[model samples]
Target: MLISRFELSVARRQLLHNRGQTLLTLGVVATSVTLIVFLATLIGGLQRRIIGDTTSMIPHVVVSAPERLPLAPWELPSATAPAAPLFVGRVVKLEQRLRKIEDWPAVVARLRELMPGGVAARVAVAEGQGVVSRESNRKPVTLVGAVPAEFTRVVDLQSNLAAGRYLGLNGGEAVIGYKLAADLNLRLGDRVRVLSSEAVSADFLVAGIVDTGIAVIDRSSLFLNLKDAQSLLNLGSAVTRIGLRLDDVFDASRQRERLEQYLPYEINDWMRDNQRVLSGIRAQNDSSRMIIVFTVLASGLAVASIMVMSVTRKIQEIGILKAIGAKSRQILVIFALQGLAVCAAGAALGCAVGWVLCDALGRIEVVVSATGRTAQLFPVANEPFYYGLAAGLAVVSGVLASLYPAWSASRVDPIHVIRGQ
Candidate 1:
């Protein structure tokens, strides 16, 4: 007990004697640790935001018919054949293999049963290409026919509306993208002519104009009632694809593969399709880690330098302590305690600094280029694990940096020092 008290007392005295140096050392450690934590929080928040935006905009898994079809060489010209049409050959009308999901309600029910609570939503969509024309102006638009009630379960398209309501699938009603509306010079109640590939044309009232923040979706997409779309596209009671939002998007690819064994369809998972975006996120994480590593080294070096100088100045005191009956181990413990004390104080202040910085950063608006929108307020991840990690790193650096100086102080010779040599 006495030895412990004496070591602590000596450590306190040394720290107090060099108050300016002690504060400087603490400031260095605190600054580095604050930066480490701030970077971590910023990265974590951005990752979550990106993932949320991606998953919300696109389905985690999409089950659809295989787009490619095997062609008969006898009916069609071979690749090596002349580019000119075979005028002598029998004329055949070009037809798209337009596969559709049959008995879709039953399929969705069966999938829900198979996965239990793992699926969040399953929406059926009928997709096709069509031309929207107003007077002389005409542009191709991608048509997505959906049951508003079910589609909302997968994507909250209603919430992103810039004008009017979502498609209720009522007679002759459709919702258009913002860019599409602008191209057609349309308003909430305006009527536009939609021409299908089958030469069928219909005039529909513009129910809503949506700005999804995704430029591609906003520029060329339109939504209408499924039954109306089927009639217009000459597809009878069939859907082109089924979109699924899972409880855990990370497991989407694996679950999609498993579903493909029983379901005769192609499955597209977001993670597999968006590898480029994910790769960019990973590169950012690597950069944040590198920054943290350098900051830790800087803190360690600062502590080491301060401890070394302190030991040099206290060499005579160390020799007297040994002569008076303090053991080498006691002297080592004193210096080690000083390092611990400095780290403890710095960590407390660093946490406060990090919190303030993180809050300030979170208030700033960040422009999301991919979405063509600004995030009004940035987010910060306040997970407990980050604080624990920062504290652990600081403590580790402090101990390692103090070791050599403490050892050197403990090895001081009392006889040589007292003899005035």
Candidate 2:
């Protein structure tokens, strides 16, 4: 029901008469909203930072050759009799040979067409296991080969370089991880011999040292030219896999599903490999939501208590209005308007305070790792959606909390109240 001007005026006057109480109720509501906004922004920022760091150097989706499997016993041909049932014997697992995608260029082209703007970058990679040695010091490493320009777009190798330049277009140049360099007692411009698992060996100049902050990659990863790696691994014009970075990291799983429909290659996304991290992030979000719900409910109860007291104090006033031919609905509307006004003001104030808090906290920097390798400011997601959500919840809570107290005020009997009962 719409509140008339007279009822609104009466509500305004009543609220102003008890300025201190009204302000206190507003402060309670504002505090609840502030907490909700702060928690939501903080949790969201942390999750983004975690996911960003984890996927920084990795591809969101990987397309590779599917695993080869031997035929089942039932599918085997019967040499003795064409119609006779095949006898089942002991089953033996066949070792998979070298896995490589020969038609990777066509696959990459197809991915580009299917995804359009969804894929930010894609690169074909020829990778293999090899051992790098400098004199007596030796270290095993996973060697990756790709075009420098294209690979950097996918893996961001340029930004993560600790020393020297990334791989050049020429052969006989290698980029080794800092940890691997340290283990081999190697330095920039130092000569090292890398022997592939297939017994192919080549000498290379250490063109760069990269420290990606990921322990496994930093310790055992190496980079070389596509031709060099392919030659070393004994793969003729074939790439082991194609890596794709998406515009939205979260779209990895959906893109993977879409690609798997038409592509014959095996497809994998980062989300599939990081289930534990995803679970932890989801848990944090769930806890934050629970806390926000309880906070708003507590604030609603506080508003209800204050409104109840207001109704008790103004019982005589309410009776006087009813005796003057004022309807019970009008009395109810007056109080409900008071509740809405307080909540609306409180929501505005709370949004301002929450933004200030988030901004201040975002400036405080902290070291993320013990090695002092990386430092970052506190993450605070400044999303307008959070502000809107908090305001909406507060307003709804206010309306609901006002109902019972307003109903009680409307039920007051003018005859009994004026008779001193």
Considering every candidate listed, which one attains the maximal lDDT?
A: 2
lDDT of 2 by residue, 182-224 (tens): 8888789999999998889999999988888888888899899
Q: Clash pairs of candidate 1?
A: none
The clash count of every prediction, one per candidate, is: 0, 0
Q: Estimate each model's TM-score.
A: 0.80, 0.84
Displacement of residue 366 (Cα, Å) in model 2 is 2.3
TM-score, model 1 to reference? 0.80
The C-alpha local distance difference test score for the whole of candidate 1 amounts to 0.82
Cα lDDT of model 1 by residue, 187-278, tens digit: 88999999977677899999888878777778788788888887777778888888998888788888888888877778889999889878
lDDT of each: 0.82, 0.88
Model 2, CA-based lDDT:
0.88
The candidate 2 region of ten consecutive residues with least summed lDDT is 367-376
